[model samples]
Target: MNLAAAHPGFLSPTGVEIVFVLVGVVTLAAAVITVTTRKLVHAALWLVVALGGIAVEYLLLTAEFIAWVQVLIYVGSVVVLLLFGLMLTRAPIGDSPDADSGNRPVALAVALASAATLVTVVVDAFRTYWIDLDASVQGSTAVTGESLFRHWVLPFEALSVLLLAALVGAIVLSRKDGPRAAGPGPVRDPDATGPAAPAAPDQPDTDTGPGSGTDAEGRR
Candidate 1:
């Protein structure tokens, strides 16, 4: 018996497949807009949509734990932190002319090459693999948690450290220097002669004989 005949073929997609395709389209559109939009804030918002769509796709794949984790970590924390950083840095709210570098063609070519490589790799790797969604929970909380902590714990902790360092670096970069501590008065030349003659004491006014007489009655 052919293994391919043991399951539903791709020609007749199930409801989950249909929903997944729809969500994937929306996610792709959002991602495209996120990259192509000239407004930074709009791009950030569109990224939220794209990320949320991915979380939805995860949910459709029956990975409930991973879906919630994606929502909380990426949609809730990461996107919110990104928007907060933008606000803190006082990023341009309107259309930013500097949003695009002068290397669009080069960037597009690189992006296309990277995308093609990734797609080819993923398709080649999973072309024959199939998941039985109805059989059992493939990614429950316990299973995912165990796998993560058991096998990927070191990398996970390292990523956390890297994120913390990035957050600190962002804070340091965004901070405005404190009004430079009032500069310790002006610097004095080490070779200056004497104590600068105490600024010459105010000279006492001398009376110009009888013609310079000033009376208390305001007559001079």
Candidate 2:
């Protein structure tokens, strides 16, 4: 009688399968939009959608811990940090045309090639594995995290160092008096404009008329 308990949105077997397909579709669409969106904030929103789709997939697979982690690490921390960076750096409020470049064709080609390679590898590797969806899934945040730290300690530390370095770099670069010697900065577009007026040669030694050059000329 109660459809909510019997065949909820995505908890039932059939619903899970259908939702997986939907999630895949939305995830792909979000990926495309994340890249193609002209606005920086819009791109960030699209990334959130993509991440949410990942969380949904994890949940459908009964990996609630991983799903929450997908939301926490990606949707929460990473996106928040990105938006913070955008805000702090005073990015243009209007559409950021250069947020991405004009190299869409190249980017798309690279993405397609990567996707094809991934598909081939996955298909070849899993051609014979029978995955039983009835299998019990463990969703332990602590265990997975411990395993990650234990196995990939070096890469984990490296990533932490990388993130710290990036934050420090952004702070240094955005400082009012950025990290640079107190010297004249490089010239911009020198050929685009007329040559700068030649610096005046060091003026010849000047004299204060009578007594100024007394030591030089022995004139008292």
Whole-model lDDT values for every prediction: 0.76, 0.69
Model 1 weakest 10-residue run by lDDT: 211-220
Q: Which runs of model 2 end up more than 4 angstroms from their true locations? A: 1-15, 141-220
The clash count of every prediction, one per candidate, is 0, 0
lDDT of 2 by residue, 1-220 (tens): 3434433343344756788898999998998898787788778888999999989988887777899989989999999878866664456667876776778789989989999999999977754444455666555677677778799899999999999999777555544323443456533335313342222133222223222323233311
**Backbone steric clashes in candidate 2, count:** 0
TM-scores of the candidates are 0.66, 0.59
Candidate 1, residues 29-93, lDDT tens digits: the string is 99999999999999999999999999999998888898998999999999987886676445789
Q: What does the lDDT come to for candidate 2? A: 0.69
Error of 2 at 141 (Å): 4.5
Q: What is the lDDT, from 0 to 100, of the residue 61 in candidate 2?
A: 78
The positional error of residue 217 in candidate 2, measured at the CA in angstroms, is: 61
Q: What is the lDDT of residue 196 in candidate 1?
A: 28
